[model samples]
Target: MLIAQITDTHIKLPGKLAYKKVDTAAMLKRCVDELLTLDPQPDLILLTGDLVDLGRPAEYDHLKSILAPIRQRIIAIPGNHDDREAMRGAFHAEGYLPTEGKFLQFVVEDYPLRIVGLDTLIPGEGGGELCAERLEWLDRTLAQKPDVPTLVLMHHPPFITGIGHMDKIGLKGSDGFAAVMERHRHVELILCGHLHRTIHAQVGGRPAMTCPSPAHQVALDIDPEAPSCFTMEPPGFMLHWWNGRRLVTHTAVIGSYDGPHPFFDANGKLID
Candidate 1:
């Protein structure tokens, strides 16, 4: 099965751009157009977090309109920029998010890969944390179906990315999270967003990765005191393919570019 991962969309009001720079709305529309063109369309679409620039209801409305073209089911978690209650109300009809929980966490057992979405939003804080309650819930949930290959979705990546500024706002309680993963070997991958760029790491012996944004990417500066900034880098998303055994990921960059030149001639001879 193929799953498409789009994160950090940060959709704003209809006429606004993100940070007065990136045109997040337009970029997301382009990304959606690209997703619609995939040959074997993704079976599911996972929105890691930051669906809007702010947690406003109108922003959510705008986001919904932009993503209306997608027919596949979308599973989303909350990011630092998201408001839990706003998001819950916005997507309540979907029924994945719990009706009474303080967190927007949920599980999907309908597919071969069991999906476990974690809520890491810390309200007004720019950083995130998975407190003991959430950690225990994850442990208990994974214990329920030990045999099923699972995927954990959250907004903040657990590992410390070398990008200093971003790392400063990274997930707290990562050590505890790693410990939980150590006990659940069946967990296939941990999908996260918030970094706004492609990054990979291993936590508690499990693979974890962050997807790129559909608009701007966090500037790649790996210093202890890197400045906080973003760049108009090649926007992109990710495709995770589960071929019955393992999960493989590919970065799908957005926008138009060069041709699909062949390495060989029509007669099968190498082109010089």
Candidate 2:
């Protein structure tokens, strides 16, 4: 099974560039185009949040239109910048959401893998939290299907990435979340977004990954004493492929850029 992950599109209304710079819409289109060209296309597209820059109806409309050409099953959740109600109104028509609740939480069970969407959005805050109710729901859901290979998807990562400023806004209830995952041995991977960069780590013995934003990426400076900011790095996404026993992840960078090509000689000597 193959899964495509896209995050942090941050679509702005009136189709304007974000942060007075990045042309997010164009970047997203490039990413989508790249995804469509892959052979053995992804079985499912897991969109891990900040789908819109401001969670406006128009922005969602634009997003829907941009995603229309994708033939794969697409699942999405909200992020700190999204308005839950607005997102529901826009996507509910597509029947992608299971409940009319504030959060988008559901399960996909038709494939060789069991996929679960968890809502970690916290209103008016950059940080994320899985409240008591959501925690209880997840705990019960995992217990109900103990034998299936499961992948949990959410907006915020539960592990720290040492990106100092971003880490400050990571999942707040990580301890409780870890406790729940510890009981579910069938969960093979935890997928997430919000960092705007591809990150991989292990949480409670299970592989956890964060997809890169299809738009702008957070600067890669690991400065522990500076303020949060973004960078001009080329946008990208992640593809997760599972073949029975192990899950493999690949990062695909999108958009036009220069440099990084190295020259070499037949004798393994640098010829640049």
lDDT of each model, Cα atoms only?
0.95, 0.86
Q: How accurate locally is residue 181 in candidate 1, as Cα lDDT from 0 to 100?
A: 97
lDDT of 2 by residue, 176-222 (tens): 88889889989999989999998888887778888889887887877
Give the Cα error of residue 75 in candidate 1, in Å: 0.8
lDDT tens readout by residue for model 1, 114-138: 9999999999988999999999999
TM-score of 2: 0.91
Assess every candidate by TM-score.
Answer: 0.99, 0.91
Top model by lDDT, which number? Answer: 1
Give lDDT for model 2.
Answer: 0.86
